[model samples]
Target: MAMPPNSVVPTTEHTTTTTTTSSKPMEVPVKPHHDARSPSFLRLGLYPITLKFEDVVYKVKIEGKGTCCGGEVSMKEKTILNGVTGKVSPGELLAMLGPSGSGKTTLLTALGGRLKGKLSGKITYNSRPFCGSMKRRTGFVTQDDVLYAHLTVTETLLFTAMLRLPNSISQDEKVEHVEQVIAELGLTRCKNSMIGGPLFRGISGGEKKRVSIGQEMLINPSLLLLDEPTSGLDSTTAQRILTTIKRLASGGRTVVTTIHQPSSRLYHMFDKLVLLSEGSPIYYGPASTALEYFSSVGYGTSITVNPADLLLDLANGIAPDVMQEHEQGETTEKDQKLVRQKLHTAYETNISTRLKADLCGLDVSNHINQAKEVATRNHVSSEQWCTSWCHQFHVLLLRGVRERRFEPFNRLRIFQVISVAILGGLLWWHTPTSHIEDRVAMIFFFSVFWGFYPLYNAVFTFPQERRMLIKERSSGMYRLSSYFLARTIGDLPLELALPTAFTFILYWMGGLKADPATFVLSLLVVLYNVLVAQSLGLAIGAILMDVKQATTLASVTTLVFLIAGGYYVKQIPPFIVWLKYLSYSYYCYKLLLGVQYNENDLYECSKGVHCHVVDFPAVKSVGLTNLTVDLLIMAMMLVGYRLVAYMALQKVQ
Candidate 1:
């Protein structure tokens, strides 16, 4: 047999010239624009590609009351794809051809290893069991375009490319890959353009469809699956996409997709067509033989109609109401019955048995069973030590920065800081004689109020990002750590800006005591406030994962903490006294009080001396010790809350 394309290419003269010449770097030759599905250039040291699925069956049960009548309705277990068994060899395209409800998409999910619900199936790629790591080898393009609304196509591709490909790959190489994928899918013309908003002005529907496919191809997945790739498209566009798909299969990558209705213009693109009806297989073979099998059983359907439409009509069967309501000389039950019988006999006797025999011969069944046993017995690595943990922190930081850079709402926090500082300074200006007691209270109040800014920002912004992040992560787009790390890095600059600016202005303007050390200490406390608040917001966001829920929880928690935070109301009832210990704000308050009053206890104000003044209980303790403790608690809160949120987020997913 000729060697499969999955095997490595030999180092021939052409290969050596391409691989070694730096002066003219080997560029993966771009295929002609019209040849949409050309194979990528063969590379050295690539892994083998293999696929296996065992008795895959996806079921959906409906048991809900009717919306209008409120009558109990129970749709018994409906098998979308019954006993679906097929092996996709490397470099093949399995086209699922069926009616609207034939469970085409459902079967695609099972085979793609993404569906959840009584999935009694085994899916393996390259002899490795399909799991989280295994998913890295597979890519799925859903029907909808999942592009970020605002980012340009290149930027969107770059963002995903950064986290997925290793740093060793030069930026030029990455861009080359993205461009290659674009060219491969015939997206070169709009490569640098903006992925349009809901209006979709920039690119055509066919271009958007190709972009969706390109996002998955960027990963160089061995198995690519799509749902309704040609849906809601013109026949010309549909045929164009299918042609690309056929080319991908020819390149030695297994491609599977469900298409609703394919015109004869696109029918030849399919390598194998699996027809389904009411959760059962009615036909599974070459597309050319489909009409022949039907006609032999007395259906005698003409090829004048679109093959996709004709097959669907035969499989779906005619409705009783339609047959009864029809006028004379319309489609009748006898005609439909004959067509159905033809399809049924063809599948029952020939196709199903052939498929079963094919499946039995390529039995990786034992390997799959053994892998499942090992997976069940294996202990989960410390959940605390998640893969790319530090990477997540980096992603989170970057994410924060991106939010400020991208979303206009974050600028409001800067406004709040400026407004608060100016307002506090004006209040101080009104009281020129800075009584030590009043100044102490002023500093404490400023520190306490500033914490709320980050809290509000995190609570509001995190929920939105959470949706996008979860969707991306679930699809295996990027590592969770990279996401977390980006958010953390991105937000740091913004997080530091408001507090740093406000604290510097207010520390000098509101003068009770002024020294280099004291100013620095006060600034530190203010920064801590930001971190603490942000951490709380993250924790709440992870716990709730809903905007309304996060908002409500953050509001209530802040209110409860403010009341119990030892500012205005302190002496709690015996029953609620323990809340003080659990409340994060309580610890923060203790640290602030320590910073404010530590100097007051040691210094006595006199007319002749530059001594610290002790005028009120608020000024009793103000020292480096209190400030240090306060800073420590805030750091703890920031890290502690984030860790807690991470744990809660896992459960949420």
Candidate 2:
């Protein structure tokens, strides 16, 4: 049906319209909803979906505030969203307005199908249960911008487009989509700017928010859900972000956002308003008619004020100036309770009854579900990723490298490694033929430093990225296996680059051996040790998703390994000697020694005297031997630790 000029579009399903000329909202005539034609409100290539829910009651278990008797733990159920019920239609912007602790964020999460607790409700998309297919079609931009701070704006959107866009679309088309989104969000100027974090500065707060929205828009989603996208921004930026959202809604998208204390102008942009008070609905209807409805119920704004401000005051159970006539100043607890009760009762009697009626008549989704077309349109959410496994790996590989490439090779790190390498070379430079202990000390330092350095560097990887991982994984952007493999493999070149450079300079300067094969073998052991140590760090980080704890464990583990590697003490206590086998550091030390010296090689005993050092107690204790076992052990560790890490990541939930 064509709408008249200067008319406000219907706010929600079968609701009334308020035109500029009318002071009161005009009721929309009810049409026979039983017709088989789908009621999706837009045609954005994909059919627009009407998101509906009824009687949504979400509760969570919380620890009791009271002291537990007999040292027993106490638990209680807290209602996060108490019987929250509302629906959003395609091409309509529904802003969930409420004060703090009113369950706005909780309600938004539930709507996005990301809520993870006990929820009792009838939430259906196109009258179908939430599934994998809907997750793909739905674009959920979290309240906090969850983006890679290191990636430029264009790169961030491009990576998302590659992973989220269907494989049937050509690469060129995906790039075009990214550009279009950037342009649409007014981000073309800052396309190349980084989405910086605490460590760096890049885009403005508003631009960052826009990038978050653009990430979702790239996919051309039918439904867009945002949680406080205007949060922590100045009024001007907030208004701009809301304006972008309104335009997106106008272009046939279902938009639902939780807003806190929006200005009157911003409040007017919302097509519908769901005012919540302590998890219960106080009002639900067209935004323009909210004050009208409240006025009929004996509590309404007396003076000209932002509708959002009035709604928030009502949500907090503090009546607007209208209540000031009864009592001066602040409302007491009793007064608040009374106000809340009255408003909730009014909503139940006047608004909820009508909403339920409209929902019944507008449940075209359920009606459509029985048709064969439903199955053709919807699928289980298990078929999660839009791209194939190889394609996901490729896209993730690019993204991971783009994010982490500079981390290991930044100027400070480069200077640190080079300085250490040069100092080690000069300190042990061309050790005299008799200084066996000095050469041995340098080799031991190599093992300790490589083992310790790389372990700490990699230990914080998983913990730092935990939030980003959870956000992306929850959306089913890519499989955990692909992400794990991509992150690990992408870091390989960067991880080994400095180690190779350090070893190259240190090896020639130390002048332990002149043979080409010996030098190569020694370098190989150092690089291999670097990799094994990094694997240990990855395992620890993944298993214990806390950075401080992981760092502490890595420190203790490395110290223990260094002590047990047979260099610190010539003799070991038999009982605790098993720790040596558990330490990759011990294996690596033994291998480096094996590369430089063997049983037959002799060092000067003293003053032109020569003896087989391998036969002596000190050299024998170091356990220099033919190359097989130590190398094999470290190699096994390189694989085994990463396997454990992968398994640990699988249980993150």
Candidate 3:
């Protein structure tokens, strides 16, 4: 195992004891660096990771319920990866090439420790078990770019650095690392630009992909695994991304990426290639040597033809008939299978066997002895958290605020709030005391308007960010509680603003209570009710990851609450009285009515020479006499809904 010309071997010292299935012990040298008190990036020396997988097979079970007489359930097993074997040494860029449904992504996920299927094989790092600590040192970039659309590239990377880098690393050092990565990935031009999505245009697709890569690179991973890094990018952009990956590999990190039908020039960038078809390896060797092996197996191509296209064609079992002209007889399915078997056997005999031998038999007693001189550094424990919980909450809160403020349709939301307020105010303009029905109608409209508006708006919150949340949470960037709390706190001000405007317009225009204390209390109650509504929406969104489903559920629940609201049903049925207690709208309506009219207030029943006077009890009739109890109940609903939403988020990842 010789280091590549571009590889940088660390100057520090550490010892790793490799324990195999056998009782014997083997020593391996792992370079160490400055103590934990030192900066993380400074301590990240040439920690080259050599990833090797032998006879790896991944299978998933699909269960179906039986429709027979016994009505039993049956399980079927599907093999995603069949006996896949390969080696990616330090400083080498290995590309896994395969067609759609060919298991390229699956294999990459398996290697990155993100796969959930049943797997059987030996995956080793530095000829030792790839434990949790080593897993933390690796980075995985999924096919989709999971990032904040509102945050600028610099802000995105800085927040990631704050959350993913260890606490021992100072904020200034983390910022430095983010800047270095930004420059390294050629993202300086877009450093201050937002990574926008469909609603808002910002950075280009290529730059967004670069930011995704930078996020994973922030940890200075020893092993970087990417799934389809160039899946949706143009040729030039794809080339640039691969070039960055090559540079990273040249720095002694093991880089493994899955590529789909890359250009010829892009194909040449890979040092090693693993071609797969139907979950089985068709070719696994040097990129330059692949054509030679294919040619020997009757799948050869001319120099002018794109080797990548030809390889993909063969891997897809669609190689042109002309390529098989060398064979004497007509081509058949049996012959194609035979050719594939021959290629597989050739790789097994000439490459896999030799690589395994080198890995098992090669001795570096001198390196181990040198590492033994210095105290064997303890295995860096799996990071419990990259930053403190408070830091995560603060960063997430800022990101949430930015996202909400810059949302493309946010102006429409504000307009909606204003429109609803104005329309309700115009419809019930200055209701008189003589018209008790109009006052009741105004209060009912206020309750229903605030309840439904906030509910629908907040329903999209969790579902929209579900992908980003899952990705970050799985990476151990922050605690779920921090994110939940930050989002709640971040959106509170905006949530209250709209309701406050609505309250201001309706309370005055509808001629509700004009007393200063009563007016302020009324506005507070409405705002709190809006919070409860939004919290319910958040819970629904988190429980159901799909926006349409969450919205439907929210609509149904809101309708139920509206119906049970006190105004809608003045005389409640004994059996369904408990349902009203569960409705936040009911409490809000009762509180608003209580705040507007007092027990001693008089109502004129008849208007004539002789007018009949009657006293109407607003609060006691609806069983909402105590304002404090109503406020307490509304607060409880707010917390209860938010708590449920948080619990739902915990189950998402």
Candidate 4:
């Protein structure tokens, strides 16, 4: 469980922490979370930041339509966001409007520093690159809500508050902050309800969306990027959410959101807008004047039409005449493509040149400030992880337990474990020790079943949490060491519970050994084997990151172990018989036998059994002299497998 000293160290230049301040909270139905009533974030003296990007182009190499002579795939460079540009000063809300494939989320991901691959652009916060400080200072909410279904809204927000807020803040303050956020987001009504998934109902969509935003709000972030925050909600709900977002932007924070389509009122609420079409900027300017700007450029607009619907229509290359074509009859894709081309040409000819000019002028100040800002930002970001190694371990461990306590307690799983134990005990009930072969079979079965049961269950652990890990890690919530250690430690007691119960019941009913020392040693051996099995599961799962693939590999791996375990085929080939030394099942079975009989005090001898029972055909490998070696090897595998998993997970991004 111990990690290297540097493993938990933050990934930036260590420096003093800074707190971001915001403007006074706006009046609303519920009380605001800022001003004097805000969370203790004010005491932190954090700085507000402006978001600026220029020439932000993102492209990917995708498979082309045609293949090579030998049927090899052809490649083509596909541009997703073609030289998109904008800037959002603090206290302004900028909205990105585009069709489904127009690169809105991709741009948002880039702003959050979560996008991967070829991105050529100038993206900065406070004239600095996306360093650790801005990472902690920024909050990015994805289009879909990613949350624990079982966690109540309050618990969800409280947990985030505890982990995300600086450790310097007290427990009471964190709770109070959670309460204030609950009121601010109008989530007070559903505070106690669960954030349910597709399988169950909990809070409404708007409430879930609010909880996602609240997670970021607890930090009072300087730069907040949300991808489609009001998507899939009614007009009233969407407006309320937008109103809250406006208030947040009013608090001297730079806010950028992607809107699919907004009502006229919601559209007017935005301070700035970036309109996109087919990965190209068709227009970028003030939200209020977008139509005016477009009208001056010669596209038609009516005052009675909702601006959002009209812009969407224009972005899709459907003009008033094209709508007429739709109303009267069918219009061709060729017509839409022609309109889209005209829009892009106008943007490039008129808007693109001006934006580039402004950007060229801005670059001088940026380069002058870049060096100092980087040093300062890195120093601040390095300090933003907030808690000591032990502190992180403590909180993560508790959260892990609370989050997973119900997993092993599921009624069907519980019944399965108990029923198997009872079934096994009945099958081998009170067998006489003289039946040496039968007793050995029982011990072997115990070793194999306990080892196999946990491996499959453990294989799914990392895959399920992969998205959560990436989200939290990108925010610098906790070091990977803390998460890995906390997860392994928390799972220990629960994973061991069923196996312990199974062993206690089976050992007595089967009457293999009555001595307390012998039973205790037997239980330790089984648990140790289980640990090794689960570690292997974790390693494979982390390496593959796909449940089905990991399970297939695990199944094949354990099958090899089972065959070489000296039971199914006692005579293994010399080439692979060495695998027995590697099989946890083999070592466990041998250890089980070794624990039953003492070296000096033998006397279980019979004509059919070896006088030194440890030397019995089923138990003896190299020698009982190597028992400690066996334990050491299994112990190495236990820790070694987990270390492999932790290392592999670090590459998962």
Off by over 4 Å in 3: 1-41, 63-74, 127-132, 296-298, 301-304, 318-382, 572-577, 608-621, 626-632
- Candidate 4, position 144, lDDT: 82
Model 2 scores worst on lDDT over the 10 consecutive residues at 21-30
**What Cα-based lDDT does every candidate model obtain?**
0.63, 0.79, 0.76, 0.79
Prediction 4 TM-score vs. true: 0.88
What's the distance in Å from true for residue 372, model 1?
Answer: 23
lDDT of 3 by residue, 221-252 (tens): 87899989998899989989998888788777
Instruction: State the lDDT of candidate 2 residue by residue for 320-388, as single tens digits.
Output: 764664356655788888999999998899988898888888846433443234335432224666689
RMSD of 4: 8.5
Score every model by TM-score: 0.75, 0.87, 0.85, 0.88
TM-score, structure 3 vs. true: 0.85
Off by over 4 Å in 4: 1-41, 44-46, 65-71, 327-329, 362-384, 407-409, 598-616, 620-625
Roughly what TM-score does model 2 have, to 2 decimal places?
0.87
Model 1 scores a C-alpha lDDT of: 0.63
Q: Which lDDT value does model 1 have at 22?
A: 14
